[model samples]
Target: MMISDLPADLLDEILSRVPATSLIRLRSTCKQWYNLFKDQMFAEKHLRNVPKQLRVLTLKENRLFLPSVDLNFVPPSIEFSDELSLNNSNNSEEVHIDSAFHCDGLLLCTTRDELVVWNPCLGETMWIKHSEGSKRVKERKPMYALGYENNQSCRSYKILMFWDCDELYDGQVDGFKVYDFNSNAWRVVNYPNCFIMNSHGVNLKGNGYWNAYDDNYVDYILSFHFTGERFIRLCLPPPSQGCMYTSLSVVREELSVLRCVKGSSKIEMWVTTNKMDTSASELSWSKSFTMNFGFPVLVYTGLLIDEDKKVVLCNTIVGDHLRGACTIGEEDKYYSEIAFEGMSLSQPPHIFNYVPSLVRIQEGTELDVFGKSPRRRGDDPPTRRGDTAMCDHDFQFSQEIDDMMS
Candidate 1:
């Protein structure tokens, strides 16, 4: 009864309990393990096993560069492969990343060339084709990004380069093009210039784009939607109207706008909640834990949860700790010794957690969690990122949004 002798179902169950960082090597155990690991269903199961509390990050030390994400909480957990191990000869120190956007369970890295969809968990990757090539990409700086699609699920994702090259979002103000995972194409729609969130990802939903925009000369938090390819604004959130010590980013599947609503003198942390009110809403953020760490002025690089847990993973300067905690009355905090040498991509660490509409893979059927859409066959690709994918990444030609999800 060796490890390979375990039945596929039982093996899958066992694999699901392991962290994603080390799952790759288990393939060498035997043909059975390799097939089980490669099967989409089995892979999905393993993904479910990856605890959301595991924090993934990009590390640049002594020219040994690697875009790494981690699930430090898992047993036997200190895995950091599937990431690039860089060196002086790489000559890439000049091309560095500044921020990280942990979309869904994946990470979006802004590189010298373009916005790349990176799966540090699986070691698979894809680069969105821009007309300027990698050289011109240095000049055209894209500040905000929301990774709507990743092609790792299928081969058509390869054709993504051909279609997306035409949709260079420059000078096309308020216009958006979603990527159709099924059709392997790109579609365009007109939009308005909303807010530009510099250090984090924005909140999202089927309804509106919750962003900061100038309303009559003042910064007003706004939500814009595409009605017939035209920009239509949604109702503004009340609390975000006038607040300084606050932050806005998407959580779960709804638009979560977090602000420092309340706090005690010694332990002060912010409170964030969702703005979606309807059947579509999945999770409502009602938890508020105060913080006794860094000053308010300290630049917050980004924030994410650990595999659907209450813990929020954050990356910051020297005084910051690996895990989230409150330092009250001089008591110490638990910190991981993961050292990131430089600050090319803002020294803040990355935490991937369970979001509002997001759930850690578990008892649910394979339907809720899929890399592809449930829509139909034969149509042009989506013009935006959040569009649907077809069954097993067999994208539909013209699958409507309602039919895809519902």
Candidate 2:
């Protein structure tokens, strides 16, 4: 029998094993196949069966880029090979992505005036306009985290938006809001006071994690659980007095952290010893590896680790006007640079992992909680912010970057 002649159950099983990239092209093969891809149950099964390929993604000047890294080389190499198309509709103007957060296969991106959930693999976009109350703090540009519940019955995606108290200006207080996909509305939530170091959070399983400091200035791994709508404080990889910079990333489906010592010129890698779903008290870490760079390295953005190859790739400012990705190898004190041309000196490029999947985005309708309509496609865009100076919340980070150079 031909492949297309197979039974529905057999075909579904076979197709679920195919990689997500290939399924994108096969969606048009038949009406049955197209509808199968839209089924929420099928999407979950496909994600589980398909092997996940984690690759580095960089955003430059509001455009998304995929970097191709080959580890077979003696020192490893990286190049910009592909760009994910963000313009899918009739509008020719490209939206300026002010910030982006990734969870599962969907990207929660924000322009100056609009918030959208985008699936690059499926080329689907869901635009969610801000509520009227959110406009009061529009100038502050609140940080966002996209996550889902860990329930087995069904998955509910949510976007957590909050302004860091330190980022507040003119004596403004912080605000917290959660955008529920089911209700298509934003609801307020109470949270504790903590300074989240990065605007973009590290997503693992169905929760969001960030390197943060409590009111006491003691650093710890801060997590926001979507199911419970609460913040939990977890221990870090032990405290180090020489630790100048600490960043978070996910590697091989596990949470990993990179700690850069100020004067020692050494960086240590740590990974969670057990699954994060366990109790916060039971969470722990084990040192993966360490490398020495002759100069003090600052890794506040993030880093990609190749445990098998013993190499780490991180983004850095090469000179006054150039930004590049430095590849540090085993037993090699020096790093090789792959400088990115035409990079903006004012805004340093941010690096994170992107996993392509078939997650579907449900676009919000015209009606909102307040029964008011949001900005339409033809509406004029909001005024843009002109200044490029780092925000006041990042004052200590700026000082540390300067100390590294001095």
Candidate 3:
């Protein structure tokens, strides 16, 4: 009763359950097992079977370690595709991230206690005015939340920026602000019921992750219908006290969320069919198979794509531990955990643009309402990199670099 002899579907299921490293090692087990695992149909199924989670890559050792074992898509031809260099000229705006979340194929970044949305595809940047809030003027990361809505005529994404305006570290929030991509401006809004925030920023994946105010004092998934210009709350299964991971993700025809337990091997999957209806709150929590085979640490930090194959591409962090977003002792987790000084020693700048989220939508099309600043698209393919100063330009071996370093 070897693995090769099992039914093909069953064998692929078992293979999908294993980690990426273990699956690669299993390729040497047998030719039949190897071929079965390598099949394209099996690849799609394996991606669906694995958890839809996020992968984080730290800037260490001049490389990015890819962790997609369940070959979801034909791996793109890229070699050590992580280390990127700064043009210095292109980086004049600072583009500091107070808080950021990805939605509708773009990044919503907040800074200066204000909000700025960027479309990396079109190379567009827009400064959205922040609505009036706490008068204290304390500086912090602006965690921006984004979501999409569709109508008979068009579709638009909403950017919501949440921050502490009060000068005091007290829990009372001064105010909340909102930005509409369609109007191309920011509007002030009344404050909603405050909820607990995940202190560490490493766990942020999608922008519009929120909960509805409930009797148990927990947040429900907040949903905005763009066409209706309305807000609805998604009733999610309650989170366990010991759980360190929870995120909103979509599975097939249903909207779902993932909750992971710390120091344990399994993550719970909750799929919803109710769509934006609050009447369907049935107080029932469902369970799914274990993903990663250990504590489901990095759920929303990776990339998941469903095309010819269901591939979850994960970028693993090199050093340090995968910290929880909201920890007990530490708060203020705005994702930009590292700081870099720009060729100067004073005024430390918290660098937030490092973790690159590879979002894939329709190949030829993108949204227009998100504001596209027209720029000549460069046709040059990204260049290969090496162990020197980070750059995309071809560098001839020269002693001038040596003298500059000395």
Candidate 4:
């Protein structure tokens, strides 16, 4: 029997097992394959079939890099691969990427003039211009976040933007907006006293969470529900007498807070026991084990936690080099640090958990609204320009398929 004569279910099973890098090339093999890969059901099934692994994506010198490390091995083996580089094309100048956030297999990068959503696996990028009101606002840094929500019938992604206003009215600011992919337009939203301290927000299960301060200068965990399009504040744990720093992160799929005391050498981590319980009074925070780095060092951010091995990945700066530290939870507390070989010390990297899949960015009404044409990699669309100096290394995907698979 011909391959085309095979049952639809059989075809789906075969395709779902393929690697995402190879699947990108196969999408253009024929119209039938293209349609099959683009189907929402196929995307969900493909994600389920792939074995989940811990991977980190970093930005340095206006380029994107994915570094994989095997925590199971002693001292952890580290490998680096270049992903994508932003530079001047024929039509526009090179763009400077301010910050990036990863959600559901897609990367959202912000430039001064616009925001771009890139699906590295599929080599597809979408450019979104800022709203007219945003352009007129005073010069203050803007915060961006990417999130998605799913229902019985369909799933949709949304981007949220809020600007730090120069002037305050009764200790309140008003530069909150959201972009819905389904609508293909930006809409202003009501955000009372919502000012995020982080450059980007962390997305978990259809909501974006941030470490934020309110009009009264009170710190809290701010949450924005994507489906409901509203904001809520969750109370934080009581502060230490001499707390030096505090930040928010995800630990084992739960909201976690990392606190550093003024005269302490160790960082204390707290995980929320009742994450699904949204009520402020009902939310509970439990103190996890402390990570002692021996000497007092800056704990920039918590990357991820390996539940099986009880290792936590974090970013730290040691004198001149940028390093990744692994804190182990064995009998005797120990930690190890590896310098990120080629990254600059100026721009510290932000790390996130990434899973490879064949998920498409635009779906349903979005596809019909945006033109039906396919956007190639080199297409000359309106671009954002940046002033950072370029690196000397050649910009390309340095690692081979074997390196990534291994």
lDDT of 2 by residue, 1-406 (tens): 7998999899889988886666755654555676788777788888788877565677767777776666656556666655654652347467777667888788988776667788766656766667432233445547788998767765788889887433445323257789887786888998776454543477887788887765566777778889889888788888889674366888866788887776666888888888677355546888888877666556645565466766777775423555577777555733566877786755667778777787775434546455654323311111333212212212332232223212
RMSD of 3: 14.8
Looking at candidate 1, what is the lDDT of residue 293? 42
Which structure among the candidates has the greatest TM-score?
A: 2
When sorted by TM-score, best at the front, the candidate numbers are 2, 4, 1, 3
List model 3 lDDT by residue over 1-406, tens digit each.
Answer: 8655788777667877653323433443455654554454554354445543323222223222222122212323222233222111244533334345455334455454444455332233444444432123455434556654543333345665456433354333334455555555555555445544432122122224343343456656554433344444545676678664344444432444555565664555565544433233333445532344233344433222322232322222222343311111011121112212122211111111222211222122222333543121222222332322212111211121112211
Determine which window of 10 residues in candidate 2 has minimal summed lDDT.
378-387
True-vs-predicted CA distance for residue 7, candidate 1, Å: 4.0
Pairs that collide, model 4: none
Task: Tell me the whole-model lDDT of each prediction, alpha carbons only.
Answer: 0.35, 0.67, 0.38, 0.62
Badly placed stretches (over 4 Å) of model 3 are 1-98, 111-116, 127-136, 139-141, 148-151, 164-174, 198-207, 211-219, 224-231, 238-245, 252-254, 274-286, 292-406
Ranking by lDDT: 2, 4, 3, 1
> Candidate 4 lDDT (Cα, whole model)?
0.62
- As for lDDT, the candidate ahead, 1 or 2, is 2
In candidate 1, which residue ranges exceed 4 Å CA deviation? 1-6, 56-95, 132-140, 143-173, 181-184, 192-195, 202-211, 214-242, 245-287, 292-298, 304-406
Task: Work out the TM-score per prediction.
Answer: 0.51, 0.82, 0.46, 0.75
Task: Extract clashing residue pairs from model 2.
Answer: none
Model 4 Cα lDDT, one tens digit per residue, 1-406: 9878899899889888876655655554555776787787788777767555335666655566665557655666555464555542235556677678877677788776667777656545677666432243555556678987666665688888776544443324457788888777678888755454542367776678877676566667778887778888777767667664355666645777776765566777777888553343345787776777766655666654566555666676555567654444431333555666677755676656665566777643343223432233422222222211111110112133325535
Clashes of 1: 38
lDDT of 1 by residue, 252-331 (tens): 44443333322222222333354453232233344344434434323233343432333333343333433321112112
